[model samples]
Target: MTPHSSAPDLIPGDLPSRWNASTPTADDVPDLHALRSRHEVAAKGRASAGPEDTRSEVAGDGAAARTHVVVRDADGTARGWATAQDRAAGRVLVAVVVDPDLDDDTGDALAGALFAWAERAGVAQAQARGLAATQLDSGAFEPDARQQRRLEAAGYAHVRTWWQMRRPVTADDEAERPTGPGVRIRAVRRESGGMPDAADLVAVHDVLEQAFADHFNHHEETFDEFLARLRADPGHRWDHWWLAELVDDGAAEPVGALVASASLDDDGRTVGSYVDYLGVLRTARGRGVARSLLDAVLTDAAARGRSGVALEVDADSPTGAASLYRSIGFETSYVTQSWHRDVVVG
Candidate 1:
């Protein structure tokens, strides 16, 4: 395996004299946020992920090996940003966004360069892992035609579509939460130290892993890997997690899991909550496990004075999860598509 210290330089050599590339840092958070916000507003009519989310993704709590690149003009102003991380063996995630204020031609050129930079970084990550090839995974909002065209230009294929859904919160929704028979939903147990019990945390992981075993892009992550990625997120709150269980004869078996994070507004206020992941095991499919868990999320978000909850669901789910979410007051706000490319390490 290639050593980290000996990793290849990812910056393109063909950049104009007025531009330079380097790994992103906390200082780039603002520029990164602005770049992403521009895309957000253009695609979804408003922004969702705030500065902290960008900060954490750029230099936050992630166990996965990653490298980020930001292009700056001669004035040292950030003009482009991209993130490429080795999420798992043979799987790399790349997110590339350029300054939206640039003229069309300059913006397109910068984007192409950044996308190429991310791909080369992904290859290095795969090589470091001693892999022959790796799959580069990236996504774009459905409305972002520019991003889609660029991804195709970078040799990525459109693979999957997801529904970004949201539901406004109200006291009445919380007061009327639904429950499942023989099932109970609650926060994962915490020890006296205010940290969650390791056992319960593992149960949540197991439930999620098993729950999504048959789902699309089902890459099994090690427990340590799972913990590091979530904990690194700035919006992650312990209280935002819930586990649904089947209780009978003095024993409880976890059947569903819901992991959520804070949704921040422009002024850094907690405006809503985002459901990062929600899953129910096959054995618990018809038992209302998913609904019970969501009820807990909606109730908690509402009680906290958060405006609403947002989540992404597979647009083509065989289980009709999007329909269920719609019936529960969630609306399809926008759509996003995943693009992937498999590349051999040089």
Candidate 2:
């Protein structure tokens, strides 16, 4: 058996003290739930799940790629947790959530242990498979002072900043869908569990791949990875997907498509519209395809009674997508940072 397989399975009986560091079981549910609840309250409800849910969601039976670790005090009280997911382009995204009351040293020790585990398992897998370097991203909604210090001291450097902005939906702000010459927007219609239309999917992927190709730290993600990752979300909705089609003189097939969806909070309120992916083929750029897609999304949000739209963009993006968002009434709400470190593979 591999080292990972040999890792101990963490369960409830073994809990209330030290975690097994290997397998995560159902008994860890309540503790994990509490951790998530605390983290969300501390983060002003920005984050939902605690360590247990995170582990189950990412490393559980349906997980595509995951690395997880738990932190505990001497008496076995869970103190902190960390996890990372493997995404397209062979990149691993890391997150560290700790109890605010813990001392800097304790937090650091927990985060450090998690990172070290990731380096050994997640990072090692990526390198051996010829994947790109790993990336660590951390977000803080409270006094992130200690969290930030821990990351920096652990050799993570700040790379990007983002805003978690939101706006209230109102009938007055609502407007009819925007359309320009040769541009049309419509909702995605999937017949069954089969994949979305092949041509449409390809166009959507092409548009996003090309549109963000020049942006900061841009990397290519496989089509399968993109589809699998989004579908894995418990909140994913088929009707929530949309596409922007650009026609030639209103006669030819669509040359571009955009995919977007709405995400609800635990209360089931239509909190916001999440742009899962947006794209416009090179042949369709500069013709308002993107603006048309945004209009459709906005219209949908307003109809659904959503409060606002939320998405992330690279702060140093070269293509100036941020400028477009600003023009559309999106603004910065919070900032998140990215850190990178080189990896040596065998």
Best by TM-score: 1
Clashes of each: 1, 8
TM-score of each: 0.92, 0.81
lDDT of 1 by residue, 34-80 (tens): 87888778766788777777877776665246688877776676777
Cα lDDT for residue 61, candidate 2:
39
- Local accuracy of candidate 2 as per-residue lDDT tens digits, 198-279: 6566656666777667666667888877677766665566666656665666664555565655566645554677776666
RMSD of each: 4.2, 5.0
- In model 2, state the lDDT of residue 99: 70
The number of clashing residue pairs in model 1 is 1
For candidate 2, give the lDDT: 0.61
Q: What is the model-wide C-alpha lDDT for candidate 1?
A: 0.83
Candidate 2, residue 130: the lDDT equals 84
lDDT of each: 0.83, 0.61
